[model samples]
Target: MRLSSKHVLVLSIASMAGHGAMAGQAESKGFIEDSHLDFMTRNLYWNHDYHSGHNNAQRTADRDRREWGQTFRLDFSSGFTQGLVGFGVDLSGYTVIKLDGGAGHSGQAGVLVPEGNSTAHEASSAGANLKVRVSETELKYGNNLRPYNPVFAPADARLTPATATGFWVVSNELKGLVAEAAHLTAAKDFNSTNLSDDFFAAYAGVASDTVDFLGASYSVTDQLSVSLYGAEYKDIWRQYYGNANYTYPLSDNQSLNFDANLYRTVDEGSSRAGDIDTTAYSLAAAYTWGAHTFKLTYQKIHGDQPFDYLGMGPGTFHDSIYLANSSQLVDFNGPNEKSWGAFYNLDMAAYGVPGLSFGARYIVGRDVDGSRMDADSPYNFYGSERSEDHWERDLEVKYVVQEGSAKGLSVRVRQATHRIGNGASDASADQVRLIVEYPWSIF
Candidate 1:
């Protein structure tokens, strides 16, 4: 089922009114009494290798990219003052030093920003936000906002996390419910030190002045929850999203979970991306028993253009798409595409090894046809492709220190391989990433 923006807004309001009782707010503590300061350091090594010998010959210039970087992040949040309306502030700073990125192996990957055919040696950025709260609602205006919802979310898959300049408001007035609204003007790319970069369409690369979204999530029961969200990409398109999740317990160590997500998009205003009308959805189910979990997912797209979302710059695909089939290397979001995935995860704690885990997933997509796109549409570039297919496989392992001075330190390794067919637009590649992180807190 599809819902319009007005319908979504009205539904959210109705849900809010239905929950009659208000969640009382706690008395505020003086500024600095409840404040927190945190510092974290991360070392990342990433390598991407595009396989040669594909029928497409245009993919030869730079087939391999490898980069290593270290990042230091500092974050501080001040406590609210004691009053009917409380005020607070949040500050964040980040610096990334390139450890390895020679001239031949630098750019195009999201690990580090390139500088004139080479990777930048170092980059840094800082931002702050002001916030006000009343009852169970809070409002924030800042350049360091990291909002995560169905409609919009920043990317943090690389050396640094992306930040946005925006005004955001969140209300938890009613128990088990969260309501949010935001107007974002710009973003800081994950690989760049620039503070404010224009927002663009992920696939079409069409620019937009701003993005506005409203969303709400409500828990109907301890095991069931639902969310609805709507957004407008300022003269580009209007998108709506809905999600439902439920979990059922079988025993002390066994459970079953189901999740479904849906999105509807249509052209609006100038339709800068051109005649977009699409519906994309995914359904996933998982069963967990003791130390192992097994999951299966199915996703589909119904439109002439590929399912796309927001981006900060060239090759900077944000984490805005919450589809189940979106994987480490590819989103599997081609036009008129259908995909399925299988995943498995294991925790070593059940086997006497604490703080260790492993995971693997594989996804395949087929029936990607973009031949129906309008001739003048920005997505026409994909019109030459029909009946394309692709697949990706990923494996991961991670370990964390559980005690002593090294507590809160973690190390992770991930590997992915993706392959595409003749008519597909994506390239076949193998990718590996090694990451180590340590964090500390100071009063």
Candidate 2:
């Protein structure tokens, strides 16, 4: 049986209300007794080397962009008060200090906010949210949200993660089901200290007044789950997403998994992005034996326009695209693009070296034809290109301290190389990122 978006939303709300009524209010301890405070520090070194000819013409002096910075994030969550309807608050603050990267190397890398020809030495911001709860349903309103849903997820790939100013509802009263709704008005970019930054489309660079979305996920069985979501970007477009995931155990130390994600987007209202109508999807399969796993993925776009999502600022790319083919350096989401990838992962726990891991992936895309795009659309710049292609290769290694005073300390390194055909507009580059993080818990 097929269910429309409206039907799914209604059903989810009805189920949530019914279950919440039956469950009654949850018993809460004193707010101070259940409160928590956490502090984390992240040190990052980012480097991007553009191939000689692929460098941006506007930044002719910057063939290689690099930045080194350290970020301190503090989060506090207060427990609900004892009552039929409980109340709580969440607070978050972030501060970043630049350790390296001057005018010649800081160019648009998004690791730090640029000031004149140089970069900011320090930046900081703070936010708070108020929350209310009854049974298993909760609502939050404020600027400290970092949602991870497919429709409007924020990115944390740089020194700091993006945050949104909005209201959101979550209900988990029903068993094995999660339902959510959100309305976002603005966002704070990772590199900016502004608490209320405008939201823009990644590819079109057009601002959006607001974003609203509804979603639900249900676990059908022990090994199967599915999710559905719908969203509207004010007057720009409407988007719908669906996902299915399954895992089967083949033996005591072996398993197989499959995941699929699909999206349908169409222009709406004013169509500010200009006549966008696209269908994009990805399918992935993986097999694991002992501590080793291998995966393969295929992704495709069936429209004249490329698949796009929310962007935080001028250069801060959001992680709203949940496709399997989106990798470290490229999204592989050109107009009418088809891509395939292979990935491998290794864990050292089986070899008595816990807290160490390695991973690698390679993806290639082809048949990127954008010549048929609308003449006035934001993507018209790509209309001169046809039958383009690109490929990327990535490698990563990470280690975490398992036991001792620095038990939670972690260090990770990632490297990627991307090359695009001449017909494509994207620049070819080699990128490397080194990250070190440690966390502390304070009452």
By TM-score, the best candidate is 2
Tens-digit lDDT track for model 1 on 1-443? Answer: 88654455455444543443323234667678879999999999988888843433434655787888899999999988777667899999888888877457635566775322353688788999998877777778999998888878888878788888988878787788899877788888887777778777888878886888898899999999999998988788888999999999999999999999999999888999999999999999999999999999999999998888988775568887989999988888888999999999999999999999999999999998988888898776565778888899999999999999999999999999999865647779999999999999977
Off by over 4 Å in 2: 1-18, 21-25, 52-62, 114-117
The local distance difference test score of model 1 is 0.83
TM-score of each: 0.92, 0.94
Q: Give the whole-model CA lDDT for all candidates, comma-separated.
A: 0.83, 0.84
Candidate 1 Cα misplacement greater than 4 A, ranges: 1-25, 52-60, 114-119
Error of 1 at 38 (Å): 0.5
lDDT of 2 at 129: 97
TM-score of 1: 0.92
Tens-place lDDT per residue, model 2, 187-250, is 8888777777778778887878688889989999999999999888877889999999999999
The CA lDDT at 270 in model 1 is 93
Model 2 clash pairs are none
